[model samples]
Structure formats: C-alpha cells, structure tokens
Target: MAYCRCLTPAANQMLVLVSRQSPPYCSIRTMFVSTRRPHKALLKTLHASRRRPSVIRWQSQSAPKKRLLNITPQSLLVAALITGMVAAVYIWLEWKKFVHQAGGRIAALSDSGIGTLNWTLTDQNGKRREYAEFRGQWLILYFGFTHCPDICPEELEKLVEVVEGIDGNPSTPDIQPIFITLDPGRDTVEYMHKYCKDFSPKLIGFTGTTEEIDTVAKSFKTYYSLGEKDEDGDYIVDHTILMYLINPDGKIVDVYDKSAKADGIIRGSIKHISEHEKLRRKTFLPF
Candidate 1:
C-alpha cells in the first residue's frame, strides 16, 4: 500500500509536467496569462516613448540652421558687388551725358552769329578800360577769383606759358592776356593790381560791381556760384575754368577748356586770329 501511494504521487507529477510541456496545454496557459494580465504596462511604455517630445534634439538642430541663415558671407559679398556695379554704371552714364552736352553746346557756339562781346570795367589800378581798347588784337580772357585754391593758379600758369610762347613767335599775332576776377567783393582794385603785377607785367586785371560781373559772366555764358560762408562771414567763389579766345574783332572765336595745353592754345589762338585779320584786310583796303 505504501508503494502504491508513492507511485500515485509520482504519476501525478509526471502528468503535470507533460501537460505544461504540451503545445495545446501551453496555448491554454498563454490565453489565461494574456487575459488575466492585460499588456497594459507594455502598451503604456510604448505610448510614453511616442509622446516624449524630441525638444532637445530639435533645439540643437535649429541653432545651427538659424546661425546659417543669419551669418552668410556670400550674401554680404553679393550685396556689395551689386552696389558697386550700380554705382559704376551710374557714373559712366553721367560722364557720357556731360561730354555729349558739352560737345553740342560748343558746336552751337561755333555756328552762332553772336560776333564778339564788348564791355568796359575798371582795372586793378582803378583805371577804366574798354574791350574795344584791345581791338585789332587777340585777347586771351580767363575768369577766376583770387581765393581759388588750385584751378586758378593752374590756369594762370598755363596762360602765362601760352602768352610767352606767342610773344616769342614774331609771326604769331599779339595776344593780350586778361584776368577778370569773379569775386569783385573780395578782390579789390588794389588787390588785383598787385596780383596782376606778380603774374606778368603785361597781364591786365579787371574788377567791377557784382552786377557788372554778373552781366559780363552772362554774356560769356560762364557759370559761377558763391560758396558757404566762413567763420568770418567770408565766402569763396566757384567759377567756370574756360579760357576764351577772342579775335581782333573782339568776337569769341574759340573756347578752350582747362585741358588745352599751353602750346596748343598759343598755336590755335595765333592761327585763328591771323586768319580773321587777313580776311578783314581783304574786305577793307586803303588803296
């Protein structure tokens, strides 16, 4: 009886082990486990992982992107290049227009029948003179002020060289060089007299009232403007730098810009004035 009892227990243990190992019994156990312990913990873990914000990663990526957008060297270079090109084109266009307009005006003056300009004004010595007084001679007229910093001196030097060259040539027509002060207010007769003496003994200086100066400037089509007042209420005058070549008939035969060399000016003035004189001699004779 003891042996049978022991055998019965052993048989039950074997039966339980077999049932746990068998597929059908294992499936029934798995079903019981799935139902009793819902996979709630696993599902919740997965949901939390999905809901977790990737805020740190996104912020790190955005910092580099923002830096790239804000600090781009190529953008600055492109902007500067565009600005430089625009400025260059504008300057070129302006220069072209100035040259074209200046050329057209010169052509019109050459064709116009304005003859010559005539006027009378006081010299630096306070002596009255007339443009007619310089008749039968070529006059090289330069309009400027004493206060001019650079251009006036340069033009005056060129004029001196040109007059000297003409005087050297016996065949060349006589050229009476004249210096007219656009700033008569500052350049008094006494100042002009001394200034003229310094330049050349033959250089005649002229000054007049502001109104008279304006009239003369207008007749020559010269432009001038007053600069800003200084600390002492003094101002500068900016005037045209053109040199006018007048024939013996006192007509504005030609105009020379500041670029015309001294030699060229002398040659051109002598040739033009001599031609006019020859023509005049033919027209009027004392035979």
Candidate 2:
C-alpha cells in the first residue's frame, strides 16, 4: 500500500490522467515506477514519517596477535630465583677448582707429624669422636689448655682469624678448625665447649683422658707440662703453640707458629691443600 508522488507537476497530472483512462495506461504507469526507484522508496510507506535509518558494516578488522609466552610477575620472579641458584652453584664449583689448583708453595716446617695425626677424642658435646671424622676436610690442628690465662686464648683468637679468613673466601675448600686440650684434667667437655664458644662456633673443642691426651700430643709432637695447684686448687699448664695444617688424608701439609700471620696461614693452607689434591689425583691415575 504505497503511493507514488511524481517528481514534477506535469508527471503528477499525467498520472492522474492515466488513472482516469482505461487499465492499459495504468499498467504502463506501474512499469515506469517499478524500473526507476530504490527498494526503500518502493516499500510500504503507510507511516512515511517513521522511516528506519540505513545501516552499514565493514569487513576489514582482525583479532589481536597470539604470543608464544605470556610472562607474568610470578613467572619473572621464578626465573630470577632459578638464575640466582645457577649462579650460586657455578660460584661453588669455581671455588672447588681454585682449591684443587696444582701449584702452590708451602714450606712445611716439620714432617715429623705428617703421617701420624689420628686420635679418638671427646668432642664438645662429650661425644667420642675419631680422628677419621675430620678426613674429608682440611684440618687446622691446635693443641692447648683452656686454663691458660694469656697464650692459649691469644693464639686461639689469632687462629680463629685465619680459619675464618679462609672460611669467608669463596675460592677455597672447607678448613675444619680443631682445638685439642693439652690439659685434659681441667678441660672437660663442658669446659672446652664454653671456652671454644668464646672464640668461634666454628672451633670444635676436643678433650679426653690424660693418657689419651698424652698419646695424641706425642703423636703431633706437642708438649704440655702442668704446674702445681695453688691454695684455691687452680693450676697452670705450659703447652706447645703451633697450628698444623693437615690434608684430607691426615698428612701434615704446613706448620704455623706464633709468628705466622693469618694471611700467611690462609695462603699456605690453601696452597698445601691444592698440592695434596694434586698428589691424590696423581696417586690414583698414571696420567
């Protein structure tokens, strides 16, 4: 139900005239209107004022790209942690290599205590520990009594500096610092523990029966002479002041005296350890 409003007054008059004429002219008018208009113009227009608007769509848009990996904050943190661990392991391996280098000069003062440094002494916890327990690590052997008012403490503190110096270094093997009492009668396990803790936790205090201590001292060529007890029952003891650096296989590598500085001890110990490692490798393999 649509009405055709002609473009001109003449066309409108002609349409009216055709309407007044017979059906043949009406058929011709229909054909003329049908051939010359858009579909919207030809649609039913009972409510012509309420015409709908035309719509258009485009077809060139695309989706966003896909990533190979979507890295989040958590993923970044994990990667950093893994990288740190790898670096730590690499540093550790390099340190081991440094400790295994073949050429370092240490003037081992005495070879008398070289092959004979085995003992089973009581540890700070009063536990019986064998000399073989310190096999795998380099030994910083010291023999002194806890009761010494001056020399023993002074020497032990100095020894601590040396052992800790090596310990703080990354390019070195572990050095196990040992304190064996020359005056075992007074230096009980509890006493030894208390005294050694005053110096360093890394210092392992050891004591045993008088006979056992005597045997151990004799093996390392260390001497101790006890003085007479006073009215209060307190006594004094004189002992050797030496720091022996022994290798993993219980062979003495270097000897340090009171004159030996911390740096000297560390340098000599590292060099000696490296040398012993080289020797061990040579022993097992012909090449």
Candidate 3:
C-alpha cells in the first residue's frame, strides 16, 4: 500500500497558518492533498467558479448595444428627398397664387389704359380741332378713307341717318359727326371736303399728316396698313372698320362695328347720356 496523509479542513487551515509563520523548511506538504479527499483542489475550483460569475455579469452588462434612433445614409437620403419634394410643392403653389394675382392686376390695368381718347388732329378746313373743344359735345367718330368704295359710303350714309335722328330727338346729346381719313397720302383736305358734302352738311371731315394719323390711330387702337401699291403708286388701305362714341367728358363710352344697327347705337347713346346727366346733376355744384 502506498502511504498517503490528509487532514480536516479546520486542521489543514491551522497547519497552513503555522507553516506561514514558520520557515519554508517547516511547511508540511504531504497533509495538503489526498487522493480520496481532495479538499484543497475543491476549494481552488470553487474560487475559479466565483470569478466566472463576475465575468458572466460583465458579459450581461456589455451585451450587444441596442441601436436607438439610428440613422443610415440611405435613410438620410430618403428624408432629404421627402423634405425637398414638400418644399417644391409649397413653393409652386405660392408661385401660382402670385401669378394669378398678377394676371388679374395686369388685366385691370390693360382695360383702363388702352384705347385712350386724348389726341389732336387737323380737320378738313385746315383748322386745328383740339379734342378738348368737343369735350362737352357727344362725338360720333369714324376712321376710314374716302377711297373705301362700299363700306365707307354705306357707313357714312348710316351716320347721316343717325345724325338726322339725333336732331329730331331733343333727349339725345348734340352729336358731332366726324370722319377721320386713314389715308393721308391719298386724301387731302379738298378730297375730304368733297366727301363730307356728299354725305351731309352737318358732317365734319378731318385729315392730318401720316405721322399724326399714325399717332391718333395708335392711341385709338385702330389697325391700318397700306396695301400693295400699283404702278401709279396708288394702293388700297386695309383698316379696322370701327366707330367710337365719345362722351361729353371726353371718355370713350362705346364702340360700334359694321354689324351694329341704327336702333342699337341710338338707344345705347341715349341711355349712356341720360345716365351721365343724372350723375352730373346729382353731384352738381354752383361756383
């Protein structure tokens, strides 16, 4: 039998304390372990197990870090695109609103600014007739050339009838019939003088230089162009067939086209004139 030695845990602890206090040669080594009862090995294993629990706690505390509110490049790109689209839509809506408001303002300005009624031109008698002179009278203004073979003559005849009708009706404003020639190159004062007499004694004719006529036409928004000239330097003139009705206050209150009839002009002129008179008397002042 092999020899072995062992002690109880309390005895072994007492012996270890005494061995530490004594010299190295006095330590009893054979009593520390036994094959049948290995208490020292068991104690070492228990201490290692305790250290393992501390490592386990460290692992639990340092578990995979959770991602809270994490942002990636792809997510960032998507958010930026969404924000840009929303901003573009908002800006576009505001731009449309601004354009709509501007369009309305421009239309209102156009209506008030175009076809104004302030101009001066020389009449057939070589006399200057300032537009202000006819401010108090109702103006029946026509723009055409004496060379107009059919439309001008017929329109002027109709104008004569209108004048005669106005003369008979005292309710209407005293209408001054005017014929302004668009063809300054062909029509002279003598030519228009003859043309007016053929229509009515009450009708007055007006002619001016080419530049003056162009200025008046532009102000009135009358369209006219010289047609192809013949070998003899004569050409037909293309123009807008329109007649204007000027109020006593020198404002263009109405216009008539070729399709307009006598009754319409008569009724419209009378109505507008009566309305003006009513307004004037209502706001009348004595100076």
**Model 1 — TM-score against the truth?**
0.58
**Consecutive 10-residue window with the lowest summed lDDT within model 2:** 12-21
RMSD, one per candidate, in order: 20.2, 15.6, 19.7
What is the TM-score of each predicted model, taking all chains together? Answer: 0.58, 0.59, 0.58
Report the lDDT tens digits of candidate 3 across residue range 1-287.
11233457655522231122223233333335444465775456445645542221122355797889779999999999999999888867765664455345434535775446566777777798777888788888898999887988989888877777776787765789999899998899889888899998889998889998998888878899999988988778888888887767677767789898877878877766665564455421221
Mind sharing the TM-score for model 3? 0.58
Q: Find the number of clashing residue pairs for candidate 1.
A: 1
User: What is the full ranking by TM-score, best candidate first?
Assistant: 2, 3, 1
- Residue 143 in model 1: shift from native, Å? 0.3
Candidate 3 global CA lDDT score: 0.73
Model 1 C-alpha lDDT per residue in residues 138-188, reported as the tens digit of each score: 788999998788889889889988889888888776688999989989999
lDDT of each: 0.73, 0.73, 0.73
